[model samples]
Target: MDLSIKGTNFLGYLPSQKGTQTFSTFSCRYQKSNEEVFHQITESELEIALEKASAASEKYALAPIEKRRNFLREIIALLEEHRTLLVQQFSKESSLSEDRGNVELARTQAQIQTYLDFISRKDWNLLHSQELNGVSFEKRLCPIGPVVVFGASNFPFAYSTVGGDVASALAAGNPVIYKANPFHAGLSEMVAGIVLQAAENNDLPDGVFSLVQGNDYWIGETLLKDERVKAVGFTGSVRGGEALLNYAKERKTPIPVFCEMGSLNPVFIFKDAFEGRTKEMVEKLSSAIKNDGGQFCTKPGLLFIEERGSEMFINAMRDEFTSAAAVPLLHPSIYNSFLKLSSVFDRFPVYRVEATAPEYSVYPQLTEMTAKEFSAFPAAKEEVFGPFSIIVKCADESEMKACFETIGGHLAASVWTDQSLSEEWMYLLSSRVGRIIKNGVSTGVAVIDSMHHGGNFPSTSDSRFTAVGKDAIYRFLQPVTLQNFKS
Candidate 1:
């Protein structure tokens, strides 16, 4: 693949724009060890990227839908051909295992293919015209122009460079400018090269797809505030996403910011299910907390259980969690934050539950508190962002209901029950989460047609749209109705 404007072997893309200014650059390092360096990007270079994206959208927005579908097909073909190397690079930059890298890379391709299939099916006749008295009405989806995607640290391939947001925006015929997560800088550049080559193979404009990398927040802010950028797609911490959203709102021409901030993803355990399958539930909850060191946005943070068999279940869960192996977080800042957030339970109200601490400085921690104690302290609801969970013992059904009311929005919420008295509890949980995962953990988010991977405030900026699945393409689509037109 071709290298970028930077004086390094590593690939990068500084979009062709007018009035580009020279920038002061910063170096990229591997997440764990800072020995060897990757490519460097400048905060000022983002200006050109946004300008080029606006220019590309002019052509891409008018391009035939079939041509756009062909672009996605070519991207999938290139991704498959370069899968092995991309996975290896991803594993190196990200602390995740090789198996996880392969799975995420494959999922990225599947996301693109899913969008392609949705557009091809004739049943989805989005372009339709109706004849009225002396006039004709036609309605269709139009691209919202230039969009910027912020890479997710957790799933580098699925949510990063050529991830869901990128595929969705491009599939909707919007020019995309991706701001790669600094944590996985090298991996982002590698994936960007593959995407650029695919774009070239299909004769896409230089601005149709551009990747910008930087070590500062200003770079992201610059893109969000740009008038040329019509929408923003992000997957990261609540603080970071909130910052970008605020910047977008502050702009003279406010644009829509689809920010998928992290979620608490609480799990409620009813008495019937807990008593019937104590051992099964323990293993399931334990397995849920171990994936990627509990770094998923859907990791169950607060678990509610009635006082009946709650003690025994808690003991079983503690044993399973402590015995499991420890996996480090994506970066050091995440590790530090994990320690500080989990340590909040070391106070008077909340206490440790026989946690078998890991050999490393950073590892999983388990804490416990009564519903009465948790209610006393509102700060207990804050997200810890690691392999940590708080088991809450409720006095009764009424107390549990009260506890549920105090909670805020979540991307995913789960309930473990035997289908007895589920209606009432499911209704109570309906407003708390975006997707009610029944009888299963919310750690795994599927890329499918009906999947709703977004939620109300605190979970995401806008609950009306999803960041995953087929519906995600609609985020970049603006409705256009033609009136008094000839068919």
Candidate 2:
């Protein structure tokens, strides 16, 4: 994995007295091979970066919105121009297929476009009402100060480096200090350089977007607690995200931490729907489970199927999963963890379905449990990271409701139904899921303006915010009010 943190000699970049930066040696996970490496950045450097960025933010924001739009347009153009190399890097580092990498790359660019389109729009600004009764009301959107963007390990270009986090932060007129994911440090540097290059060409400030190589959790804690940082964005495991959020809250000057931890996105299938489209459902299931090695946060890890289709669904799920190509997980730890947890599912007494092939060898597995049993069971509530799913068979519609009630918070949910069932259940699920899907797979999250990519509680630190789509800017922007103004 050619894992190397660079610039050890440049400890001067560390955060000042308020910031202490140190680079450490860590093995990279994305690659099949190992390489010793070191990265150097100081707390002082981070502070300076943030300070300079903060200073430039207002000016950057004041620039013609069209110019910002053009910058993102250029970025999209560059992404397309270098699409081939980006695809290759993604495949080599993440062990993803070239096609999947390309799709992600395209989505990443689309995210940039979405942000640009949003920023250029006039309606994104707050609206206000004025009254002649000696009082008026006004509201507006203002960029938060410097933002700390913690990138994800699974997605190098899109979710890491100058991915959605940075893109959204930039769109919000906030300078970003992106902490690259350790797994894709090289890729981070590569993309960060590109972004910096674009910024320089566009006359953006040096500190507007700075990339630091910190391969440890301590660095993130340090940054999260830093008072200069106005906001934070992260995507990773629940434990990791929660830790960051907790640290931020514990700080003397706490800040908003938008941590999209993880989710066991549930796919609910009604008895009628399941019976009619078992084959179609299975095909969709296969694609979703195997999509990008099932690394997406929105991947449907839990399936709620009615009793009648349970047997056929299990068989098809297994058949499709068995045929899925085995790809190396990002790291040996992930691989081992998936193996260990999957074994635990086999040991569970309620497990009903058998695998089409040995579970350990393949990338994803299909395991089944009855909805009643799963609802009553505490152990079944956990999420197993890799391409693993727990099928919950429901006896009836009521059982499905029970299953959902028992399920934990999720990033997204899917209801495979043609006709609306009961309005109560519909409202219940609609209120619960972050991104609700109907008659389709739950995996592919489109990068669009209206897409809601967040959910309540553990699915994300905040329910009202979205991590992707045009609305992502809201994470980096806060509402302001202006009253009795005449321009």
Candidate 3:
């Protein structure tokens, strides 16, 4: 398992560096540029890659399920064999700790295994056959052709190359074109190489998997506009997802863009809940805000509480922030954006912890405002993508319900209460989010069959589908019914 980094695009099984335009991934840990300079995939190369993927889709989709299962197994074995190297590169490129990198690597492997177990089942394709009035009809899931996946910056392994999107797409028998996130191009290339090796070892199609490297927006725009691309998977900011969605719309034939954009993930704490478990709730909330530098899409950005124990919760949170240490973001751009977005709280009442953080790091802060003030302040609702949260105080249950109505869709909304919530509250919360949590933080997403990782409207393009879990494969599959077909 002597894997080496080439810092070039993987056009199927072949490594390409035909483009002169190049960029280097920055080492967030060392605060310096990585040694390898990666060549961007040119328009001509992208076209070739798309052509190969389009051609390969037919064969890959029709290939035996055993071959696909073997492909996934090989990928898992390779990832495990080179786990240490992958974790090291992941840590170097993303500035995340080695332990976090290992966790993400294991998660990535587990995600692939989930898909593997799904496709290995007898009912994997959801096939159905019925005969009525001397007519026979059969229906089953079919691949949607080539899919383009945009890697995310935060989780270099689990959400980036060889991540959930690629795994589910491949498992569903769809060819995948992975666009490497420029911030972690080197690590992405390394993982891409592993996937390509697995494809080659399993004798998969030439264009079954491809990696395109570039930072320019046009690279993604070009991939989205091509007719060969049947679907897309994206994980990033709202602005980036909007751009890709618009690009897909501009295409003569629109395609499904399954994007998991960031969310506010609000937490509602009832008076009783707050007063009863003030210390415990504060600890959980603080950990949620500070974990992974608050880079998770499900990080609780909004905290709603009744005015009765609002002061106590605020005082506890203030102490927690002051004692907490700061952590570095994925990149400088993200760090700058965090600073800019969190600055909106300067006009409001805010408490920030002062820490001598490293370069590209941010301190934890808690901002406060009344429900009336929150409603009046539009900017306060916007997600500040770091270890920052806003506490909204409400006069009573009515005011709290009114405030909840104003919030748009979110990935998940948590309710902390000892007793059951009202039907009205339950309905409102369930309607506004894809997942509802009780007495728990929304930071950790379980990669199980029942997990729904997407949300309504702005949280995701389609709430009906999830970006995680076995159901994610449905995004790359469509149903085809055969009439009067004889087996």
Candidate 4:
């Protein structure tokens, strides 16, 4: 296994050995053609990586703000320089579409560029002071200690090794130790390599960044328990996020954990809205369900459709959802999860069931249930994490209200309404979701400053911070105040 840390240096360590060669192993296997081993980054390597990160934090924090800005700029330039290699590796490992891979590669560069642009503003860390007689106080943002970032499985580029968390932490002047997501471990290593080279070229300390490739929970646990790690950032399933949270809390000095877990992002369609915009909703939603194999955290997995006027819309959706051939999921676990959750949905009295005609052919599956059933069972609201959606027929406004009460915290929601919404309905939905799409699909998340990619409990650890957009940098920054100090 190859581990990268503290510059462009590499360490070769065996996963497990006997006597003097004893070492732990962490292997990542991707599902492309045949399952092939991606990489193994050992425990000893991870310890050394953290040590270097801690050492780097002192210099990185005190380094001129301009140097950090230049470091970020160098990363963006290097990403652009190796755009082809990144896109190729991302596609080859994840089996995502070539054009999509290229777009993601661009998005990665853009994410870093967003941080760079924000960091260059210089006001991010500015101090404000007020003098009263002989007393004066000034406050400014300071970098939290080295941060541990857990990457995303579905989004290797935008949310993985070089994802928003890593970018935001660096932008705020914190050293980042990225735990590579197993689904794209190879890409993570490559991105780490690029950052190390770029950091060395920019004369930044090696401790500013480190990447360790491992698929085990213990790796995350180890990092969370490390006293030197002041904060952690994560994006993945609820179980994974919660495990990291638990690890953090169990530590003697618990640290802050910012986790963005998956959610059952739901879309509600009013009858009047259904009457005027059924076609638009159907087209927009069908693409959302199929795109990225429905692996997105904000994918509209549940729909609250009006009972009276949704027959045509539902029929159109069924055809659209089932017509497309299923692309392979990121791994076999996701595929099996789709199968298991299919059985779970079957346990309920389904209004409709549509899947690819062949048994083992593809992954897209659509199931329907009444509003009453959807509210009755907790499992119905749980995230399936694949190309699966449940349609809940809402007979009236009251049922929709009841449905909203059952909804857990979500990253986003959509209300496709042509007519005015009652204040009650607006209030009900607004309190439960972060980003609300007005009459549009909830899938496409733009990487702009105005976007808020977070939500309430169960959806994310903190609603105040976002995983994407400009506000994300704050997660890695703390504030300090100096009294009676001179400029």
Best by lDDT: 3
Q: Across residues 213-279, which tens digit of lDDT does each residue of candidate 1 receive?
A: 6656777878888888899999998899999988988899978899998688887787877767888
Q: What TM-score goes with each of the models?
A: 0.91, 0.88, 0.97, 0.91
Give me the displacement of residue 166 in model 3, in angstroms: 0.5
Off by over 4 Å in 1: 2-40, 123-129, 348-361, 420-424
Residue pairs with colliding backbones in model 1 are none
- Cα RMSDs, all models: 3.7, 4.2, 1.3, 4.0
- The TM-score of candidate 4 is 0.91
State the lDDT of candidate 2 residue by residue for 237-303, as single tens digits.
Answer: 8898989978987888878899888788888888777667788888887788766567778778888
In angstroms, the error of model 2 at 386 is 1.3
Tens digits of per-residue lDDT, candidate 4, 231-276, equal 9999988888899888888889977899999788888888888667
Off by over 4 Å in 4: 1-39, 347-361
- Tell me the lDDT of candidate 3: 0.89
Per-candidate local distance difference test? 0.76, 0.72, 0.89, 0.77
**lDDT per residue (tens digit) for residues 144-249 in model 3:** 9899999999989999889999999999999999999999998888888888888888889999999999999989999999999999999999999999999999
Clashes of each: 0, 15, 0, 1
Best by TM-score: 3
